[model samples]
Target chain A: MLKLQGIRAGYGRIEVLHGIECTVGDGEIVTVVGANGAGKSTLLKTVSGILGIWSGTIELGSTAIHKKSVERIASLGVVQIPEGRQLFGPLTVEENLELGGYAKRRSGRKAHAKLEEVYELFPRLRERRRQQAGTLSGGEQQMLAIGRALMAEPRVLLLDEPSMGLAPLIVKEIFTILGELNQRGLGMLLVEQDARLALSLAHRGLVLERGTVVLEDTGQALLNNPDVQAIYFGQHGGRRDSRTESA
Target chain B: MTFEQLLQYVASGLTNGSIYALTALGFTLIYNATDIINFAQGEFVMLGGLSAVSLHEAGAPLPVAFAGAVLTVTVVGILFELLAIRPLLRSGVLTQIIVTVGASLAFRTGALMIWGRDARPLPSFSGETPVRLLGATFNRQTIWVFGLTLVIVVALQLFYRRTLTGKAVRACSINPMAARLMGVSYSRVVLLSFAVSAAISAAGGVMITPASFMSYASGSLIGLKGFAAAILGGLGNPLGAVIGGLLLGIIEALSVGLLPGGSSGYKDGVAFLILVLVLFARPQGLMGGRIVDKA
Candidate 1:
């Protein structure tokens, strides 16, 4: 479980996250949907300790992590699959996955076990285990990014735009994987520009507008809300119109 | 020149090239980790040589002297990171690079104060008996240089490819932010890079001092050559650095042997010429595909 309270953070003097509060309960997938520059990535970066918060506290299961180093935060199991699928471009897919479990430095058997599990989840990765990450296609790269993060054996995964730049079919596959992982009880805080899919999969959803939470509701309720539909689902409830009507 | 004469030049070239390879390897480690061209890299080499000489003069056994010099210089590298690098980490890459230049000056002046201006010799690891190979004769130190450089390179390759820490370092070099998210400590990796880099350069310094007597000012030229070698091979690629070093050394030796009278005087200029040529023609070096991050 992860919690943030009145968190203020930014680049230099310009604040991006203005006293925002949020949480991801046990085995919960909390999706934050917002427009560009709405501080979604900043919130994740703050939680992962890549950026120091100006004020307020971030706690992972009651332990304060606001001032910890990025590595310390990660070792505490707050691993982030960064925006843009920032996999080690030159390293082999297996090497990238191996590095994911670096914090714990798992034993040979344990690491091998984790590797096997990840490969099972992404069989394409096993086939291309020796290939450099940069050479992978966009969908495969996204899979490798998720597979790499899972290698860390994280308790709470922070995903930033996992669907960005991914094709619709690939995004569907990714969301399916996320839903499957949540069913297995892996907590997640997902930031997405794909509001419909994120809400459909999320148990709870928050609409982030310019660094502030403008709305919070059950995913289905938010999906059916008039304002949410107007802004995110488009006036006529863009393609996949059937789902919007059903909601 | 006779074939034996050519063989002799290559043999000599290889001996010096081993030193350049070791020094360039140092540059690669630090450059890969921090993206800062540490000007003080040469200082570590000079420190290694001077410290070993002092220890030898003070009656420590040769092996003990060499090991002590490496340990001393490694500690200095760690201190430099903690005291100088850690403070300026947030100050941007250019500022940090400038600080290294300043550190080099400080190290040079300190060496001057401690050891003065005289060049000091480290007795060869083994007696200077000439070994013959195909009618070309070279000293035992040449064999030692080759053997040690080979050992260091093999050990380094194993480290990068086989060990978790080494992979973590490689990961850091590739993507520091991503590495951090994976729980790899960036600062610790940087520190390890500095320490290992200093130890390697120090070892090279200790080994080569017997052949080329070292003074307080010796680090500058050797460091420059090493940098040139790193650039020639591809700055981030370790194997490239070693090959570049050997090539540069051989070219310089060949130039001295074949060029007209007084050409030997320009032996040092050869590295710079190669350096400029590599930058203009193939900025990525021979092995690298593209410049990943620039300082």
Candidate 2:
């Protein structure tokens, strides 16, 4: 489980995340949907200790990790699959995955075992294990990014825009994999721009607006909310105008 | 030129090439890890040679002297990182560059104070006998320089390809933030890079000093050549750096062998000319691709 209370963070003198509180429970997928520049990525960075928290507490199962080093936080099992699928472009897919298991590298066989599990999950990665990460297609790169995070054997996986730049069919495939992993009890905190897709996969959802949590409810509840539909799903319930009406 | 003469030039060129390659390798390692060109890289070689000479003069055995020189330079590298580099990391690339240039000046000044202005010679690792090959004779030290450089380069390649820490460092080079997300400590990798760079450069300094006498000021030209090699090979690629150094040396040697009278004096100029052409024609160098920082 992960919890953030009264979290405030920013870049330089410009504050972005202003007094936010959120939680993701064990084995649950909590989706946070927000418009561009809504401080979603900043929140994840703060939790992962990549950015310093201005105020508030972030905890994983009651142990405060807000002050920990980025590496220490990752070793404690909070790993992030950052935005844009930041795989090492020059390195092979296997090498990128090996780096993901860096924290556990000294554990010897355990690390290798985890690597095997990752290979099993993404068989395409095994086939192109020697291929440079940059050469992979967008969907495959996303898979490698997620697979790299899984190599860490994370307790809570923080994903930022896993569906961004991915085709609709690939997005469906990735979400299906996420669902399957969730059934295996892997906790995920997903920040997504595709509100419909994210909400459909999540058990609970929160709507963020202007660095603040504007709404929180069950995924179905938020999906059915008129205001949510109006903003996220687009005009007229995201349906095309009828021919007679247009005429 | 006769075949023997050509072989002689190549053999001599390879000796100098190995030294430049070693120093360039240092540049590549530190640059890859921290994205900072450590101008003090040549100073590590100077420090290594000077320390070994000082130790040898102090009556320590040759092997012991060599180890002391490497260890001393390694400490200097770490201290440089702690005292000079670490503080400037957040101050942007320009600041880091200025600080490294300043650090090299300080290192040179310190070496002057310690070793003074006179160029000093190091005894060859083996007997002073010239080994005869194909009607050409070369110093035994040439074999040592070439052999040792080959061993170090191969070992370094293995380190980058086979070791987890090495892969993590490569990951850092490619994407520091993504490496951090994977629990790889960026600072630690940078520190290790500095240490290894210093050690390799120091070894070069020690090995090359026997052939070319070393003074406190010797590092400036050597460092420049090494920097040129790194740039020629594509800055961050280690294998490229080695090949670049060798190519630069062979070209310089060939110019001396084939060019008209007094052209040897223009050897350094030729190296820089190549560097200028590389910057103009292909700034990425031979092996360098455009590195996209996705993180």
Candidate 3:
């Protein structure tokens, strides 16, 4: 399990996360939902070691990871798919995936095998293997981002706003892929703006407000919670919208 | 100018251009990795030539002296990175550039203190025989310069395209945060770039020192020429740097040959003239695009 205790982190002189505590267990999906500036992304950055915690302990299984560098944290199996799908723009899709596989320091044969698996998961990437990553569509870029992270063979994946800017149909496809990966024993800690969809797919969900966790419950119970429905699911519980959008 | 004279000038221009291209490439390598124009790049060349001269004077064979010089300069380049750049990694780009300028000054002064003010000579790898080609007579060292530049360019292309480590360096240049997330140590890339860049420039120095004598103060002028070439080609593009160097060298040589009355004195001015015109006319250079691509 990846566990955090009293995590406090922020940009210099401005605290974004205040005493946040969370846990992502083996083979589980934990989704965090919040409005903008609620420290959702900050939480993930701290865990991935992209942002240092002011005071807290980040432990992956029995290993203390707070002092580890970003590369070290990633090599220890906590990989992050950063916001905006930060692909190397001028590089080909295959090159981007190949670089991701470099994190593990495995043999060329193993990296090739991993490349094949990534291509299997995202068939479009295989078709566009030689194409520059910057030319891909928003949804395709998101898939490539996830595919890149998977190349690392992470024990726990931290995703930030994977559904942002993507069409509903594409989001559904991506979430389905995420569910399949979770089913195959990959642990995910997801941050999403779409609360209903994230809660539905997640095993457990948390409601964050301004850097603090306001609520934590099982996915089913969070979906049923009146407060969660009122704020996150809208006044009508989004019944008039698509099923994925509504609670 | 007579055709043969023009040809001779072209030959000499090409030799100088090769050296400038190598120095510009060193500039490009560091610029791509850290966005700093390493002002000390030409100092590596100077160090290489002088080191080889001293080692050869100490009774080492020409090839061994050349190798030792390159190795020594490579170590200096790495030390420069570890001592000068690593501490300022978190600082602003402008500050880092200023540090490189300071480093260039320090390197020049240090060279003066060590090697004194006299211009020194290094024996050519092969005996100094004049080779004639297409009505142009040139020293044998010119061929070595051309051959080494071609080899380095090809080797660099293969490294960037075919090797995983080279791709990792490219990845870091594109997006350092993403590279870090992917387990690439950013500092290592910086160190590697400095080492490779220094070694390349040192090779250029070793090749060209026999053609023209080297002094402690020679680095500043060559450094300016290299910087001019880099700007002319487009600052971040490696191939462009090579082309720019050759073009600048030829233009400068042609000016010396064609202009009337003591125009040789104005040869250095020609490089800056092109630099000014290029900066005003097309700052992105001939091969440079809207997007900056680094090797």
lDDT per residue, candidate 3, A104-160, as tens digits? 876668888999999999999999999999999988999999999999999999999
Q: For candidate 1, lDDT tens digit of each residue in B188-285?
A: 99999999999999998999899889999999888999999999999889999999888888988998998789368989888899999999999989
| Ten-residue region with minimum lDDT total, candidate 2 chain B | B286-295
lDDT of 3 by residue, B38-117 (tens): 98888998998989999999999989999999999999999999999889878877778899889989998999999999
Is model 2 an incorrect, acceptable, medium or high docking prediction? high
Number of the top candidate by lDDT?
Answer: 1
| lDDT of candidate 2 over A1-247, digit per residue (tens) | 7999999999989989988999999998998887777788888899899999999999999899999999999999999999999999989998998988888775578777887899899999999999999999999999999999988889999999998787889989999999999999999999987888898889999888889999999999999988888777754212122222335
lDDT of 1 by residue, A173-224 (tens): 9989999999999999999877888899998999888888999998999888
DockQ of 3: 0.82
Candidate achieving higher DockQ, 2 or 3: 2
lDDT of 2 by residue, B158-270 (tens): 99999998899889988898999999999999999999999999999999989998999999888989999988998888988999988888888888988789367888787
Query: Each model's DockQ?
Result: 0.87, 0.84, 0.82
**Candidate with the larger TM-score of 1 and 2:** 1
- The number of the candidate with the highest DockQ is 1
Of 1 and 3, the candidate ahead on lDDT is 1
Q: Chain B TM-score in candidate 1, rounded to 2 decimals?
A: 0.97
Stretches of candidate 3 above 4 Å error? Answer: A235-247, B1-3, B289-295
For model 3, the docking class works out as: high
Model 2 chain A scores worst on lDDT over the 10 consecutive residues at A236-245
